[model samples]
Target chain A: MSESDLEEMFTLAVSVAKEAGQIIRDAFDKEKEVDTKLSAADLVTESDQAVEKIVNTRIMEKFPTHRFIGEETTSESGEKHELTDDPTWIIDPIDGTTNFVNRIQEVSFSLGIMVNKKTVIGVVYAPIKDEMFTARLGKGAYLNGMKLQASKITDLKQAVIITEGGSSRDAKEVEDKVKNIHALITHTRGIRAYGSAAVNLCHVAAGRGQGYVEYGIHIWDFIAGALIAKEAGAVVLDPTGCDLDPLRRRILCACSPEVAKGLSQILTHLDMGCD
Target chain B: MSESDLEEMFTLAVSVAKEAGQIIRDAFDKEKEVDTKLSAADLVTESDQAVEKIVNTRIMEKFPTHRFIGEETTSESGEKHELTDDPTWIIDPIDGTTNFVNRIQEVSFSLGIMVNKKTVIGVVYAPIKDEMFTARLGKGAYLNGMKLQASKITDLKQAVIITEGGSSRDAKEVEDKVKNIHALITHTRGIRAYGSAAVNLCHVAAGRGQGYVEYGIHIWDFIAGALIAKEAGAVVLDPTGCDLDPLRRRILCACSPEVAKGLSQILTHLDMGCD
Candidate 1:
């Protein structure tokens, strides 16, 4: 895609993200009628569905030809889905739904555009903090109007890494992720989990942290952030240190090339079960 | 202290916190002339000292008989430290100095008052986020304008725990903490590190997480937060599972009585090498 094409996608993604953010903000403080899916910890509310409906409809009405993928619809429609080769819009209406449901104010909307099965533009907006993070394929990343880059710290021992424990769907995998985390903590700098993949990836892009690793996030959770981190000069890979497949969700991201290499070495030394 | 007396301390603490916050905020984006103590990370700056000076002077002028302890001044005067029997103020000009120096926006000013060596009134304010967390011995805890309480999560497997990987001064303890964390991940729900003890403790008070643990934090870091969490109906202890000595710095906190018991049991089971 040309620079102008990526720029256009960025503009559209930002607008869509803002629109979705407004939906979330509107439902922020009202009495929440909650529904549990897996258990008490894993929950959903009317606001989550309401926000997703607003985002999906806005994007489809404006770009009917573009393919669409969203979290809520996917959960209802079924799994084994794939993004088409045509221009596709991947969206997470309210990333950090737990935080939103609990009124923690760390939720956001993530929107990404994929062309030829590769992400080319991305945008993430957290309305509560009034923070917007955006990027194009070659254009650098920006946060709140300031140009952003990953950190200069190249040593794994000095880096701050973020990772999630597990997904609600896979309790066993969550346990496995925790074990891998055990092995990684001894060799890495530090660990954090912010409960939002989109925000975590943006923080990696902005040099707030050196890297992020998560076992099982959905495509919508990472599509925008993986592109943003790549555009901001970071290495996006799997936990096993392979190139990131845009269609896949499980990911490992490092702020710089050297830190990526160091992280790989540390993981190898620890004998972590990663693929 | 009476209700009105406690209110007076809170008001004073709030005023001092805002004053120091402005000083830190003004220096946040500018070129920092850091004075590195040991390495680049062990940093101090004129801004920190200035803020401490402003706070200490304000406290002294208002209550001349009250004692004051601040990071910059304590490190400067090289004085023998003691928590006297009289009322004393403990202050951390900037709790997460590394975060502040790195522009991570996770740092804050911490002010705690110990009456007869027991924390009775505490206040922590993150000027960047404009969040003021306050607590009196029995008056209850609050964040911003709302009342606060620790999470109601009773099951250890459903809890989100926060902890820190310690500084270089305590490398062996840092490694031990990692091993303890390794044991924790396999059994608990999730883990997070936000780089600031005050912020992490405040999150617990707001019911955002189940607990927090750390090693070698000073009285200034844990004193304010201890009272806040206690006021929120949580339990505070040392790693040994005993009620923490108020004058001491190290801390282990949990949301509810049952959760705290479960956590203390796990720490004992894992044989975490803490003193």
Candidate 2:
């Protein structure tokens, strides 16, 4: 996408995100009726649906031709959708649904645009904190109107990282995430679990945390923030060292190139499963 | 321990914390010559020393004969000092030193006052984020002048938790922390790792996250924030279900009492090491 096209998309994303955030915030203030999906650990709330509906409506009204994907609507069908050959809009109205439902206030709106199967424009905004993160391919990233940059933390010992495992109830899945934790504990300065992939990636982009890794996250949860981190001069990689599968995505690490390479190598050495 | 006395002590703690935060911020913006202790992951920076020096000078001058326990000077001697009566002051000049050294911006100044060897006043200040958390015995906790309270998350599956495991080099220790995570993931809404104990506990107190659990942290890392969380009506417990230790503490959880009990039970049922 051209720079002007990216700018327009980002502007539209910011607007949609704000509109969705207002809906989420309104639902958050009202007493929420919480429900679980698959298991108790996997939470879904009325606010999530309410916010997603708003975002979806906004996008559909503005760009009827664009391919749109949303977590609440699309993921249930469990079908793979390609981000290639056209501009595809990916939306996560409430990326941190648990945070939203519990009124923890770290929830965010994550929106990304993919051109030719690659993320080219992205915006992730945390309205509660009033922090906005935006990026376009080759245009650099910005957080709250200032250009973002990763830290010059070269050594693992000096790097502070954000990490989390899946919310899956399967013991083996939990064990896999634990194995990654086991590999990282002594190798890095410290690990932070901020509970939201989108915000955690924004933190890495803003130099608030050196890196972030999570297993089994959807594309909507990461595409926007990962693009922002990448444009901010941080490296974004699949923890498995393979190209990220946008449709059936899982593990990811966004950090400075040095940290990303170091972490990827360690995860590789330990035979940790990222898929 | 009187309310008035606690308020006065809280004021002193806030003052000391702000001053210490300024000292650390000044060093952060200046040159950093970092040194390591236990390993590369254990960092001590000039900022840490400078903040400690400033806090110690101010407290000693104000209280004259108050006993002080600090991370820098005391831990440097490799001597473990127990908390004392006679109005003891517990200080972590820069908790989350790794974050400080890495320029991750989650570090904070933590101060806690113990009267009769029990925490009575607690303050934590993160200058970069401009977040100030303070509390006194029975006066309740406040963040940025707003009263703080734990979230009323009764169900474990609906809870959003934050935690971090220490160096995973020790397979046994890593396994123990993982066991806790294993149980938590199946029950909580999600898990987060925010890197700073002071900040994590404060987040819990502010109802940002339901709870925070961490392994292998010192008293200075959690003393003030734990007390603050307790004052906010959150239960602070060692994973073993014992009251959080006043000295050389490790493996702790801070959350609403019911949630804490539920989490403790889960960890126990899973036969984790803490129990």
Runs of candidate 2 with Cα error greater than 4 angstroms are A1-6, A268-275, B1-8, B29-31, B167-171, B268-275
lDDT (0 to 1) per candidate? 0.75, 0.76
What's the number of clashes in each of the models?
0, 5
Q: Say which candidate scores most in TM-score.
A: 2
TM-score of each: 0.85, 0.92
lDDT of 2 by residue, B161-194 (tens): 8877653345566667777776777677778776
Poorest lDDT segment (10 consecutive residues) of candidate 2 chain B: B266-275
TM-score of chain A of each: 0.90, 0.92
Deviation in angstroms for A253 in model 2?
Answer: 3.2
- Please give, for residues A138-255, the per-residue lDDT of candidate 2 as tens digits: 8899987899887767777567778876566677667777767766776777677766789888888887768887766778889898899889888787775666556555545556
Candidate 1 lDDT over B134-236, as tens digits, reads 9988889998868997777687766777777644334555556765665465556556677788888888888777888877666777788888888887888
Q: Which is the leading candidate under DockQ?
A: 2
Off by over 4 Å in 1: A1-12, A28-46, A76-78, A81-83, A155-157, A168-189, A239-241, A268-275, B1-9, B31-46, B72-81, B149-158, B168-172, B179-188, B239-241, B268-275
